[model samples]
Target: MPSSQTRPTPAPLLKPGETVVLFDGVCKLCNGWARFLIRHDHQRRVRLAAVQSPEGQALLAWAGLPVDQFDTMAVIRDRQYWERSDAFFEVIGQLSARWQPLRLLRIVPRRLRDWAYDRIALNRYRLFGKYDTCLLPNPDHEQRFLKITMPFVAKSEN
Candidate 1:
């Protein structure tokens, strides 16, 4: 396989030290997870992106993932892609110390963890629910998402 650094196209850009989470915007379970991340990531270390969005598509392409057949959520940072259960841990790793305990889940063998994750991901829409259209992010958290077109708000240059 060709190295990521040698890919013809440039890697998707992200803010320094920021990890971008790409998920299915229409899946209720996924939307809920996004809300949970928004609520707990106090330092705003994570950014959200819907797999259907331009930014997410670019990242997926860069990661050599199938943008059209997206089945699992992913976390990307510093040109690295973390998928399935690993993606979950990647985001958890960026959270506060309170989340440190969750790391113990790693003790459960990655293959098993990934198998469990696959079951949910494959049936996410059926098990949870899905929207006909992608739900837009709430105004309060719009800034944390990529490809969102929130209403214009002037900022003081001070």
Candidate 2:
């Protein structure tokens, strides 16, 4: 199998037709963002997974991102994976007309946009506190979360 460092496409991670939002499970801010997505996404266009979960780990492996270091939000749509502010814009832009305007942030240089995103991400736990456990989706929304068998673990040498 390809290693997590290889940068995989998003399509294979989804079912026949679906998208996913992979987020930091312990971060309150990220949970808030996921809640925003759940509320605003009327069409149920995307599913959510916590980066600490097995499903999230699998997707991270497929995307070639380290499962141990989830410093950015990830949105997987239309067979592509977007990270950081790009992921933020892409998810919101597709939600509704009201959110479309947020896409304008894309005009900013990626390096600049990501730098700001990184700062907030780095301090999110300090600013917002953390959940002792991953946030649980509402009972009605449980199906929208992806489930996995187990996380992929690399071999270690003694």
Candidate 3:
């Protein structure tokens, strides 16, 4: 059996109105997506957390999701949890115009969309080079991430 230590720690209690996005920290593609969101989200409405983080684990448990199945992106919006393609679309909907157009993907059936997402997720490590560790956020974006056991932010030049 996988040790409980391998499982993520429970997340901290979040205030209402916080939308947390949990992702695979070591996945290069996932890290890129987080940076993309941070860049496009001019309003700074979204908060990011890694699936391996305590806060992320807590949120996954609260949402009744299996922590081991976090290979793909997960979005917690309005207190509701979304995974795979559904999570992707919902996140785009919250972004600015260029990203909002992605919301049209909702027209695709959930099963079909998630099937495609799963395929990419399965091959992500092979297709997109993974990191030895998660990407640390730059200082300017530090406020965007919730601190976890590992340092998730890089030092600022300032």
Candidate 4:
């Protein structure tokens, strides 16, 4: 994870009332989390974006985060952005009432929580593998995804 001193000064990625989640497009674990959110977020108040997409890159640029290294999930609410463990808690806290209990994990210190998060993140691809291409949302959930002109594509086989 990027240090606070190196992290970007956030720029607005969504409208004042919108909340967007930026995740690694090909990370299997991240995709699972996205699916989890879809199932549990009864209010459907959040939108999703792949960190490698154009919009994601632009937002990262504006937020002063490195576009090349996506080590943490981000939750962008209104004009604010939270990454690492804070991002997880922020999103879970707003989820369905039954899911809100996940927020209790915040009782853990930020450093310890982020350390665990980073460990899993570092091994995510090795442990869970990666998708050949970015995952597209189902038609019913299309509106919940931020469209990017340039989507990630898997390299062609020779």
Q: In model 2, which runs have C-alpha deviations exceeding 4 angstroms?
A: 1-13, 149-158
Tell me the tens digit of each residue's lDDT in model 3 across 20-80.
7898988889999899889989998788998887778877787777887767777775446
Q: Please name the candidate that would achieve the greatest lDDT relative to the true structure.
A: 1
lDDT of each: 0.84, 0.80, 0.76, 0.80
Lowest lDDT 10-mer window, candidate 4?
Answer: 1-10
Candidate 3: Cα lDDT at 40? 87
Candidate 3, clashing residue pairs? 11-55, 11-58
Model 1 scores a TM of 0.85
Q: Give lDDT tens digits, candidate 1, residues 92-121.
A: 888999997887887888889999999999
Q: TM-score, each model?
A: 0.85, 0.83, 0.80, 0.84
What's the lDDT for residue 75 in model 2? 75
For model 2, what is the error of residue 118's alpha carbon versus the real structure, in angstroms, after optimal superposition?
0.5
Q: What digit string (tens of lDDT, one per residue) describes model 4 on residues 1-158? A: 22222233434557666778889999999999988888877788888888998888977776777899989898776556788888888787768788767777777888999999999998999999999998888898777787654678999999
Pick out the ten consecutive residues of candidate 1 with the lowest summed lDDT.
Answer: 1-10
Compute the lDDT of residue 153 as modeled in candidate 3: 94
